[model samples]
Every structure is written in structure tokens, then in C-alpha cells.
Target: MVCIRCKMVLKDELTKLGLHYTVVELGEVEVVENISVQQHDQLKAGLLKWGLELMDDKKSVLIQKIKNVIVELVHYSEEPLTINFSEFLSSKLNHDYTYLSNLFSEVQGITIEKFIITHKIERVKELLVYNELNLTQIAALLHYSSVAHLSTQFKKTTGLTPSHFKQLKEKRRSMLDDV
Candidate 1:
């Protein structure tokens, strides 16, 4: 589950199944008892209705952890990234940077760098819409070297400068919960 409401849906489904889960964190859930095959099947079916997958592999597990980390950092955190993103990801996932980068590129068909950039741009779009923070503030919050850097990167990614992106105020911001 990627959002609080998604967690709520999972919780409701678990309750309907009479299952007692101790924790329902992003990327995982902990149940108090072993579920029978029949119960598992039913629970899986219910979860499927909400478009949630029950992942059960080491690599997919790691991928989800990586996504969760990126999602949290970009969409949820308010502070600028403290260090280089590669180092931040390496420490968070407890894996070497090269391994994580290779695994992510192999599985997702895109480098983790691209994924982070897309998420950052999406966050910039949201911030731009709010209009509470100026261009300089957005650049600082997202850890761009300066407003010029953020503008240049934004233009490269979206084919429009930050001011142009902001001018299209009617455009919808990508939802973090979906990504």
C-alpha cells in the first residue's frame, strides 16, 4: 500500500476476514496468526480488488523497499536531501550503490536517478501550484544548486522552464499516492 487510505482499505479487508494484524506499514504487513490456504486465497482476492499485489520474492521485496524510500524522500519529507541521493539511497537500503542502481535499472527499465528526478520534478510542480514558495525556495527545498539549476533541469525534463511550467497553472500535479 502506498498511502494511508490504501492502508485503511487493507485494514478493513483484514477485519472482514477476521485477521488481526499487528502492523501495517508501507511495503509490509504483520499478522498475528498464520492464515490457512483458503483464508489466504480469500484475503488475496480482496486485496486484489484494491489493486494491491502480495509480493513474495527477494528482488521484488528490495525493489519495493527502494520505491518506498524514494517515495518517502520526495513526496513526504519536507527538508532538502542532506547528501547526494546515491549515498542516501545506499544507506537507506543497506546495499551498495552499484547493486541498487543495477537492480533498479534491470527491473524497472530506468535508472534510479531518472526515477528520483521525475519525482522531484513532480514535487516542484506541486510546489509551483501552491504558489506559497517562490522559485528560489523551491530550488533550495529540492536541493538544486540554485534557481538556475532547477530551472534548467525542469526545462530538460518537461521541455519547459519552471516559470513556463508554473504559467500552466491549470495543469494537474501528479499524485504521489499513485506513483
Candidate 2:
């Protein structure tokens, strides 16, 4: 689950199954009862109908958590990331940075840094399309050192400079899920 609608659907499905949930945050749910195997299977099947999966594997869950944290930081939050990303991830997920990086790369076939850059670029595309903040403001918002740095990364990722991208009629910006 990556969005609010996803969470709402999951909550509805859980209620239909008579399971009481205390929380239904992105990528994780805390149910109040000890669900039976049949209930678990029912919940999984229900979620599948909504194009969601019930994750049981620890590593997969951890990977999802990593993705969730990045999504929250890039798309949802306004606060700047004060700490180094490695330290932030390590502290948040309670795992060594090396272990998390290795596991993320092994499981997702992309390094964590690459994943972050991809999302950041996507967010840049979003902000540019919005036209509310100029390139300088966007650079500061995304923690880039300067508009030049953002422009370089943007061009490298999308084959179009940020100004050119905004000027285009189509203004192609991918959805967060697509990223």
C-alpha cells in the first residue's frame, strides 16, 4: 500500500473480515487479534482483489519499509533531511546501513542510492510541472546544492533539462507508483 486510497481499501477489507486494526500506515498494518490461517488467507485474497499483496517475508517487508520511508520523505514531507540518508535509514529501520544496502540491492536489483535518486528525480519532475516553485526553490527543497546540480541530474535522468521539460506541451511527469 503506497497511498491513502490503498490504506482505505485495506481497512475496509480488514473490517469485512472482522479483524480489528489499530493502524494501517503505508506498507504495514497492526491488527488487534491473532488471525487464524483461514482469516489470513481471506485477507490476502481480499487484498489481492484490490491489487495489493500481503507480505510475510521479513526481508520483503524491510524493503517495503525502506521504500515507504523514501516515499514519505520525498513526496509527503516538507522538512529537510537533517541527517545523512544512511544514518537516517539505519536508525529508522534498526539495521546496519551495510546490511540494509546489501539486502535492498539483492532483493530489488537496484542500489538504495539509485532508488533514492530515481524518486528524487520523479519528485523534481512533479514540482517542475506544478510551476509553483522555481528551479532555485526546488533545488533547496530537494536538498540539491544548486539549480545547476538539479538541472544536471534532471537532464541525465530524463534527457531533458528542467526548463525544457516544463516548456513542453505534454509536461510528462510519472506517477509515484511508476517510479
Candidate 3:
């Protein structure tokens, strides 16, 4: 689960199944009691119907957590991050940066840095479409050193300059999950 709506769906499903949850945040859910296999299967099936998966594998769950963090940072954060991203992720996940990076790459077939870049670019697209902020503000908001650097990254990722993308009649933006 990467978004609030996903959490809501999970909460509704769990409630319908009569499972009390202590919390449902991002990629995790804390149920109040142990459930039977049938209940687990039922929950899984219900989640699947809503286009969500009940993750059981530890590695997959870790990957989801990583994705959730990125999504939250890119899409929801109000200010630019102050510290290094790897350090932040390492501290948040309680693992070494190198180990987390390696596991993320091994499971997701992409480096964590690459994933961050992708999501950041997607966020830039979203901001561009909204037309609420200009390139300079966007660059600063996203923690880029300068607008030129943001422009370079935007062009490299999308094959169009940010201004060009904004002027186009049809702008194609990826959903957060697709990213």
C-alpha cells in the first residue's frame, strides 16, 4: 500500500472481516489477534479485488516500505529534506544504507537512487501540470541545486523540457503506483 486510499480500502476490508487493527500505515497493518488461514485467504482475496495485495514475503514487504517512503517524500512532503536521502532511509528503516540499497536493487531490479529520481521526476510533472509554481520554485521545492539541474533531469527523464511539456496539449503523467 502506497497511498491513503489504499489504507482506507484495507481498513474497510479488515473491518468487514471482523479483524480489529491497531494501526494501518503505509505498507503495514497491525491486527489485534491472530487470524485463521481462511481469514487470511479471505482478506487476501478481498484486497486483490480492490487492486491491493496482502504481502506475506518479508523481502517484498521491505520493498513496499521503501516504495512507500519514496512516495511519501516525493508527493506529500511540504519542505525539502535537510539530510542525505540514504541516511534518512537508513535511519527510518533501521538498516545500513548499503544493505538496503543492495536488497532494493536485488528485489526491484533498480537502484534506490534510480527509484527516487523516477518518483521525483514524476512529482515535477505533477507540479508542472498544476501551474501553481514556476521552474525556479519547483527546483527549490524539490531540493535541486538550481533550476538548470532540475531542467536537465526533467528533460532526461521525459524527453521534453519542462516548459515544453507544460505547453503541450496532451500531458502524460504516471500515477504514483505506476511510478
Question: In model 1, how many backbone clashes occur?
Answer: 0
Q: What is the C-alpha RMSD of each candidate to the true structure, in Å?
A: 5.2, 4.8, 5.0
Give the Cα-based TM-score of candidate 3 against the true structure.
0.92
Instruction: Give the alpha-carbon lDDT of every model.
Output: 0.86, 0.91, 0.90
Which stretches of candidate 2 lie above 4 Å from their native place?
A: 170-179
Q: Report the CA-based lDDT of candidate 3 relative to the real structure.
A: 0.90
TM-score per prediction, in order, is 0.86, 0.92, 0.92
lDDT of 1 at 83: 89
Candidate 2: tens digits of C-alpha lDDT, residues 16-59: 99999999999999999999999999999999998999999999
> Residue 6, candidate 3: how far off, in angstroms?
0.9
**Mind giving the per-residue lDDT tens digits that candidate 3 earns over 1-179?**
87779999999999999999999999999999999899999999999999999999988988888899898998888776679999899898988989889999998899998899999899998998888999999988888899999999999989999999987724444444356
User: By TM-score, is 1 or 2 better?
Assistant: 2
lDDT (Cα) of model 2: 0.91
Query: Which sequence of candidate numbers ranks them by TM-score, best first?
Result: 3, 2, 1
Q: Is candidate 1 or candidate 3 better by TM-score?
A: 3
Ranking by lDDT: 2, 3, 1
Model 1 Cα RMSD, 1 decimal: 5.2
